[model samples]
Target: MDVAVAGGQTATTSHQLDPLQRGLLTVFRSLPRTAESVPGRPTPLVLDVGDVVVLVSGTDRGSPATRDAVLDLATDAGVVVLDDLPGRTPTGRVSLVLATHHTAATAAQHVAVRCRAPVLLPDGRCVTPGPLRLWVRPEPTLTLTRPDGRQDVVLHDLHLRDVADPDDEHPAVVDVFAHPSGSGLLLGMTDGGAGATVALSTGPRCVRVPAPTTATLDGVTRTIAPGTYRIDLAHPPLYRLHAESAARPETG
Candidate 1:
């Protein structure tokens, strides 16, 4: 089926647009944009148009910061997000909605979308946005005092200031590696240090794809040997998927 999809085309009179075209233009142009635009370039927009004819409107010609998408799409076929879309993200590193599930369309992924983590969109193409999960690092902590420039995925940020003896505090150093069982964050494990890192949070933690030796994360893919990269979820609470299922639309 042919479905009209308009992102940003403005400065047009009413006479030039049909009822549907005009409606789309109004939804596309009237909504706020967060990304900066160049005269000869593009801007990415994310809008959460009120629950009307649409749900989410992402990667349009407006702004990059808008958290909600306000566009409507009706298609029986599939939609693909090309690699070029990522380049238009907002300044400073930020998460961009590459794809999403729509009632009228079907989306499938060969990599990142399948595992529900943010990985490189192979060949610059996005799969089913429905399955793409946002995996945030536990805020990598680094100190320059050490010669190695030791970095850590801070599972816990609050270092007991006055509660514990100053000398007995855990340094919060972490060493990540692979676990044959699954893709989950392994906490309470010691890094050969006096103290161990732990998780007291609710969200599921991420495990190195395959193992730490084959490092690839943060939307950045590394060229490594096969059988070395596999994404896993760790310590995922039961309520996470419960809430996730409620938010996602059901498809036949």
Candidate 2:
């Protein structure tokens, strides 16, 4: 797992922080660090003003069943996936981050000063217990293959392969993202002339993103050389985040 911090310089894995780390946390709004939030990977979940971390622990890491369920939840919620909660939240304090399971053990992951949980936080009552889920949500990932032939689990992905055109020249980059209703700029093809066409469809379909391209899947980004690319996926699913209507207790 890699650290995905947005702001602090010093990384404090222990809940007990040194005076310098505590001072830095106060000085900065957020800090970026390569925290292995879990024994595995990372994805984006949101926190709001007076909010902290959203912990995600999956029963199925890369199972098709899990992906489908998450997609469906996002579709029903009608909120778009985001890197963090800058504009998505009402207070908008840039306090949100998508940390993995057992956040109580990984307080240094998000490096936030506080967390928003239903019960009284072990730290103190910095955040009120209320219905924050109506606005805050988690951005789950859809597993996909990247250009360099690696397995990548990402939030919101798009790819176009097997386009039946040879005369077309490649575009500088591949563009892909979608809305909650299963529609958006659903494509990854050559920059052909006006006659070019593609059958954009929803997931459980296998597709490839041809080489020599770069893609930015919301918070995740990658690039591939002319021939160095490979992507393995259970096909495409909805490009959105999973949401819960009922608020549950979360670790900060």
Candidate 3:
């Protein structure tokens, strides 16, 4: 990890510190000398997930001076700085502690100077709880090769839950884009058994087209309206032509 030290010196080094110690120092530095009173003693500091500790002379009259001293110590320690607080009870207190990467032992020393509370730091090593190897299923790739050597490929993917229930029905998905020359083509795919339909709002109301047996399908045509249109590919899917002009001329 990268270590940022005082005097603007930064270096890559491996070192460890105690988490509890860090927390203690943070608490010591942040504790206010005097605040609204509790029943008999001062209000105790509450430690949360990410807190750092620093040590200050408990008898110090001013909180600002103590905090500054703690900041200076942190700068010299070559560890990242954070906030701290005093723990409950009259005897001693714990400070909050945190680190940029992981907890370390140096924090323990800082905590020891201030409070009698035990120092705690997270283990330096990172432990991945769950499966290290991700369950990444490959996306389905579809390739269409025409007799004339023209070909196209489409990639399709669905979430595991979407296909988990074998009985649930789903609509096919189709996309059609038009060229500047008043011509367009259609590309889409559906579930293994699901069919689809196509349509255009301006020219053709509904066109019936059968879904391919595989996961992906594509078709090319030179006769489609230039205006925008919506292609529907619901169940019982079929492709139809509402207007004769919108249909592609049958080629030999």
Candidate 4:
């Protein structure tokens, strides 16, 4: 973790200041990391995971690199942000705390900050809780390998993978996610889409050529698309797609 103060200097580093002056700095200083001062020009911003990227300008229009870096780190690594930069809550990427210097110009330029959780903002004289917004986007993906092993592709993974089937005989195996509904999802192929029989804890499901085939489970017939699909599972322990032979069915 790292900490960056955006106002050139803050009470946090001042020896003459009180405990409140330190704000989150008291905790940030305890962590082992490097601190950097952001300049008011667009410089290339490079970052590592779990970095504390701070911006301190209430005006200056600081480095665009720093601004984009902070948001990118937050999106990828959930980095902590302590910004008093003079700008609207930089849209997109969650986990943000915005504060600005209380001034007539700032008041006119900035809008009311709205957050799902409580946040502290700097108001020139003191730090206080204010309305702010929190944005969270949890989109994920999973890869499924076709039987031919000709083409490889990625599919959206919207559900949890809890199903497991271990085969001691066939050590080389793979798993894929899917739903019973007809979603028209396609499993990525490496070379071909040959038909093969895949084993599932539920039972053996046949993979036919030019699939999007129909399978009846518990007397209900449903279409199974060619690509990997994310099942709308309701329970914790569910099944995954596994093969019975040395030939694995999926790659990712």
Alpha-carbon RMSD to native, per candidate: 16.8, 17.7, 27.9, 20.6
Candidate 2 lDDT, 1-252, residue by residue in tens = 122333322222234433322232222222222223554454333322333333232232322232233233334333222222321222233233332222222232222222222111112111222222212222222444433545443434544332222233653433334222234224344544444334444553233445445555434455644442333222332122121123456989
The sequence of per-residue lDDT tens digits that candidate 4 reaches over residues 1-252 is 112321212222334323332332222222223335457632222233554433333342322332343354355544666454344344443222332222222221122122111122232222222211111221121222334432211222311121112323332222333432222332222222353232222322223323354433223344544533322222111111111112225878
Top TM-score hit: 2
Query: What's each prediction's TM-score?
Result: 0.20, 0.29, 0.16, 0.21
- lDDT of all predictions: 0.25, 0.31, 0.28, 0.29
The best-first sequence of candidates by lDDT reads: 2, 4, 3, 1
Stretches of candidate 1 above 4 Å error?
Answer: 1-84, 91-174, 177-197, 201-252
Worst 10 contiguous positions by lDDT, candidate 3: 236-245
lDDT tens digits, residue span 135-186, model 3:
1111222222332433233222111101111122543334322211112223
Which runs of model 2 end up more than 4 angstroms from their true locations? 1-126, 130-141, 146-149, 157-192, 196-211, 219-221, 225-252
Q: Tell me how far the alpha carbon of residue 200 in candidate 2 is from the true structure, in angstroms, after superposition.
A: 4.3
Estimate the overall C-alpha local distance difference test score of candidate 1. Answer: 0.25
Q: What is the lDDT for 152 in model 2? A: 43
Worst 10 residues of 1 by lDDT: 237-246
By summed lDDT, the worst window of 10 consecutive residues in model 2 runs over 118-127
In candidate 4, how many clashes are counted? 22
Candidate 1 lDDT tens digits, 79-178: 2222322213222332222222221011111112222222211111111122222212221211111113222122112111111112334533344432
By lDDT, the better pick of 1 and 4 is 4
lDDT score of model 3?
Answer: 0.28
